[model samples]
Target chain A: MERNLHYLKGSFLKDRLFANNFIITLLFVLLALAPLFLSDFRTNLLGKFIAYAILALGIDLIWGYTGILSLGHGVYFGLGAYCMAMYLKLEASNGKLPDFMSWSGQKVLPWFWKPFVYAPVAIILSVLVPAILALIIGYLTFKNRIKGVYFSILTQALSIIFVVLFVGQQAYTGGTNGITNFKTIFGFPLSSSSTKVTLYYVALGFLILAFLFCRWIVQSRFGKVLIAIRDSENRARFSGYNPAIYKTFVYCISAGLAGLAGALFVPQVGIISPAEMGIVPSVEMVIWVAIGGRGTLVGAVIGAILVNSLKSMVSEGFPAAWSYFIGISFVAVVIFMPYGLAGLLNQIKRKIYTQKSVKQYSSAALNILEESGCDEYVG
Target chain B: MLDAICGRVKPAEGKIIFKGIKDVTEMSEHQIVELGIGRKFQVPSVFMGITIYENMELAAARKRSLYSTLFTKLSKEQMERIQDVLQKIGLYEKRYRTPAALSHGEKQWLEIGMLLVQQPEIMLLDEPVAGMGRKETDKTGRLLKEISEKCSVIVVEHDMEFVREYADKVTVLHEGRLLDEGNMHEIQENPKVMEVYLGRGGEGCD
Candidate 1:
């Protein structure tokens, strides 16, 4: 009996040592440790990656699990960034109207811009605007059952239209230039190292929170319905889950997260532009999710970091070849990883655990039954 | 059973007053399913992406949130219930295999396993043995007979042999209307059923 207890404890310890949980917590610890040793530039780069990860996770919630591949996620991100930028722009002007409008010969700030001049309202509006847009779009599209590639095309069109409008509207939106060269965020100078570090950690905190939030959502009952829709949408409908409601909820959540990420991003990146909200940039975010593993949270983070960090290195090292690298990598990950890097890791983890548990459990259980003299009862 | 078991195919029309005042429009399809009104499609609607076990787990996982499903391990009791249902349908060996790899007969059995796990108050199976082989059809008939002992089962099938073997009661649907409802013998010999089943374009062997 004592021997059996020891074996069980040993197996329990063994399981904990290499569990998916252990790995995830370890990675988080590593991320926390990174900034301590890394320089400001690298820390800022990591912050940028975390922001991108947030976007990818939101997209994955909509596109990967819910099977609603949206092209308008960039618009959500843009909305958040624009809101944060509006506040920054307002603060930079020091209670006066912004320079661009002053240069363009405007006497007063627009009524719509007046509300956003306040930080709290801008943040609320930033998240709300995208959610409201997504809710409407999701309602119209999903109710009509406009699925497959058609949905993708419609979203892509939205992205193009948003970019065009943002670009063309120069006076109100800052047009092609966008609201940039921000001197302050909530009265704190961006030039200060402490502020930069604080913002970096803020971005990191938000990213971690987003990851945990998504992780919870994906593991919830609502998440099973999502996978059901993904696996077989028709089945989910007949089973009594309104696919539209699930789709709408997840899409809004995705939009809200993207908007939140954008809000965080603007402070760190210090700009919001039509260029960043364009068709290609939005599609590139999708690529990050695809290459990382769409269904897995960590995959989103890893893919963002790996791709962006590589891009940073390549831009400095090889410049123009970066696009070629991105293109080839996208195709390679799609064709080879099919499940993505996280999926590959999951497969390895499963095999290891399955082998270990099957062997250890059967022996332990059999011995327990034999000792207890209840083998028949166990069967 | 016959009037309560009337021709209303749309579950949205289900009206059951409990103590006379609470509206259950908020009750979802899965809630209705859990409340014992099991539904199967006209065509088999298996989760084609997963294994027979995982498909059952997906239904079982409905009881859990996405986070619990992703993080928490399935308890032994849950695994046992899944295994028992699979074994009842003789698909225990194929539990680990994907639905795409399953044969039409196995797919039917898999659906039955899914229903068995759910153990609904009423089982609504549509064309349960539509594309199944003779032996597999016999196995399905036996499975249904076993399932019928516990709940009210309504099967929508064109196979006269399957209905005759398993149905305690039969309802014939023609042009989205319930043409006739009775016991298997009554439905088999009723002039209206004969005329409808044998008379409906003679496309099927009566």
Candidate 2:
């Protein structure tokens, strides 16, 4: 009993586990009913936001927990989007070269694009390619002990290189215009409202799955190690953990999650451009994780949806001032609410619980003292 | 020298043979740690952000692989081992507190406890009682004496009193070269050791 009490004291795992479950359930319920209450266009917009939320989840896993700030996540996201886009384009073209390739005078399908003709192959490649790339990059950087600002700058450079490469290959990648004007996905009309709604649900499902997966990782002993690494890499290494290998593994996993989000995103948004894979979008992705609460999985999702929603609303009204609004909000979050939205919520909950416990303990102590005084007086 | 032996730095020209085999001149720190050689830094390097118990858990992890750490739950024996170390270090009451909450000497004890949980074949502690009060230093001396019974312990310290009380054999170094080697009594009587410690030309003892 004493051991159990010891385990329970300050174990954030026990309290947050219940709260996390409740929030997840509520979120799914809201997502499931969103289609019924919203128009087709709005629902489609929400689908796109859900995709960003998935990407933010990936950012939180790497940057928030592992302390590996990757500004090159857009590269993985773009790779997955392109992979899915290739398959969709092939299905639309009926086994011929996509329109842009033919327009550019290429008579043959690129050998790399051939494997994506099969849906299963495309999906598998979409996830694996990004993971593999991340593994190689992680091995190179981490093995050399390149970390902190250096790692972030390296990732930013990667994003720029990918953007330039994608834009340069006009015949293969569709260049700055990106792959678009798709008519169908697996014989279902992409333009159909019903298809859009169905795709929205699919994106929502994947987002929840990604969130749960991240939560599982963070709760496990592995997650504790990641936090330990973030706190002090040298101390963790001295404790026998190979910090490089752990960093590489988490980096690859983060890349894979971003890839999955991009795979879903391409179909919903109907475009996968070099612009989407550039420095700005990648930095914006980090901002979402930052504003949400770096370490909290739910905070990442909330931050993504809220920031993107705010962006759309602000842009629709003023157009030129949305960037200013985003900048101010990021600064405010950093200064005033460093822990982000979830952290604020946790703080409030803790305050209330602690106050109530304090009251109960004090009152019990007073009663004991009074009874002891009465006993002494009677004696 | 402990840093060199633990592969934190490569020696300019030397080989470190442990247990009469496997020259560890080019081994990485992780490989050296795997060879049953544990090292404690001069400064207490416990993870400050985590609870002391979690620090113990990290040190007690057997596999140390990314996947195994993710899935492996601590066995009853592992828990008992951690508890034993905590009790031995007298930090069981503060196990749930972060290392930041600990006193300097407590942090030192926690690091010693971390090493003790690993149960290494050889332990290298650097200045274990550097900032400790007299009471804590005496306790540390007792602890080291107890630890030496289980494994070979080499402590690098400048505290002559601690060395005299706890150390069975002493190797004295002067200006990065071996000056004398003997028990504390013999070292006190040696002329060269005296020159290095007390007979220096009016500079005063270090």
Candidate 3:
């Protein structure tokens, strides 16, 4: 009557994994075929959401599990996007340097700009730049024992600093407007319908791959060590696990994934800017994870999708007070649904099954009542 | 080993050797932990985000191939060892539950269990009964006595009752300095220990 799970001896855990993977696989298939039926707009929108979901998962890995809320992850995301955006910009320029440079009265390309023309170099730099930044920040903060709300604030400050630097250096970074107007990726036409579709599916493939990578990490001894740091960092040290190393690993992983997401996102959306990598955007990224469900991978994915979709809808409908709507949504969910949407859905599922099981249990009691002559007690 | 370290010069300033090795200051904490000089914390530190099984697995330090740990699943044998350790700590029922939900005493109990799985030669415990009730304390005391048979136990506890029941040799520390070291009876009767642990009037622990 109570679901008969205990007798199965871990069958339920195995089944849950299988079921989750199966659902993810189905989602992948659905997404892959979506471009065939849906218009370019829907596929592009879906591609954008998938990219955002990747970002959310990345943030949640550090903020949710390790308890290190990084508001600078958006900076990492932007770095990756800027890398891709630069390559796209260079390709569009046809081996010539960007127009803005010539307009600024430059004769030759910048030395730092030469390597990014290579696609592989751009991708590698996208990952390396963010990893290096996170490494430096993580090393400094953790070494100083700067944790709790202070660490969060530090990361947020880093985000602000990155955005300001990029904006102030407009001569090279395209200023506040950032880079856009891309026409090709690895020599493929960007505006072509099929390329767009292929990019969307490619994004889907990468998201699934990222999910597998994250799953491997969260299921590993490294993950366990992260949990240890979350609970009691000092205790983790006493147990022979240097909390600094584990934190650094997770932080770098989170940043690298954000970079990966950003790389994919730049092509699909055809834009990358200083605005997208600042403190506000980073905070927004965290909200996606929070509104979905922190610490649960599916929840992070679902939350990113749901929140971004709501943003799209609300911005279209209200356009003026969408931020207000999102703010209210955040407060309501945090107050009433601590576990967020996934937790609420799980509760609803539990309730429905509980209602059915209760009815069956009552019927069983009724049979006992009839057989044992306990009708008086029932009445 | 006892004479060199008991009340002698500081460890960093002077050489104190163990086993067959002498003047061993180059060993890392991980190496020290691996080489039988085990230490436990004041708080259990039971990795709140993951399950009890994972905490045990880390303490067991028995992973086969670091790469395999990342790619492959934890084996049945690993799970069984985890369960066995959880059972030892009386926390098998809460194996899947996180430490955030565990009571203070239960966390302490879990700390004890996780450390036991490490198989340390000289276990360094800190107030193992701090935040526990009489039942939990009594159980922990018995467990400490049982554990002390195989390994030397150094319990840094203020609970005199726990000390009286479990300590084979009691060392009193006041203001970051050891005041006395002897069996419980000798420590209780010593003038300095009485002044430090007991009240100024020379009354015994309540």
The candidate maximizing lDDT is 2
Please identify model 3 stretches exceeding 4 Å from their true place: A1-6, A349-379, B1-35, B62-84, B99-103, B195-199, B202-206
lDDT string for model 3 (A261-368, tens) is 899999999988999988878888998888888877777888887898888888998899788998999999899988887677667755765676667567666766
Give me the candidate number with maximum TM-score. 2
Residue-wise C-alpha lDDT for candidate 1, range A1-379, written one tens digit per residue: 6567566656654674457567667766777778899898788778878788888889988877877788768999999889888988988888898988887777799888998878899999888888999999988998788998999999989999999998887778898889987998778898777787888888878888988899888765567668779987866654545677778878899999899988988888888898888778888999888888887777787787778888899999998899999999999988989878888888887687778777877877787888889979677
lDDT of 2 at B147: 92
Q: TM-scores for chain B, in order?
A: 0.76, 0.95, 0.78
**What is candidate 3's local distance difference test score?**
0.77
**TM-score of each model, paired residue for residue:** 0.80, 0.93, 0.86
Candidate ranking (DockQ, best to worst) = 2, 3, 1
Q: Lowest summed-lDDT stretch of 10 residues in model 2 chain B?
A: B197-206
How many collisions between residues are there in candidate 2?
A: 0
Judging by TM-score, tell me the better candidate of 1 and 2.
2
lDDT of each: 0.78, 0.88, 0.77
A305: Cα error in model 3, Å: 1.7
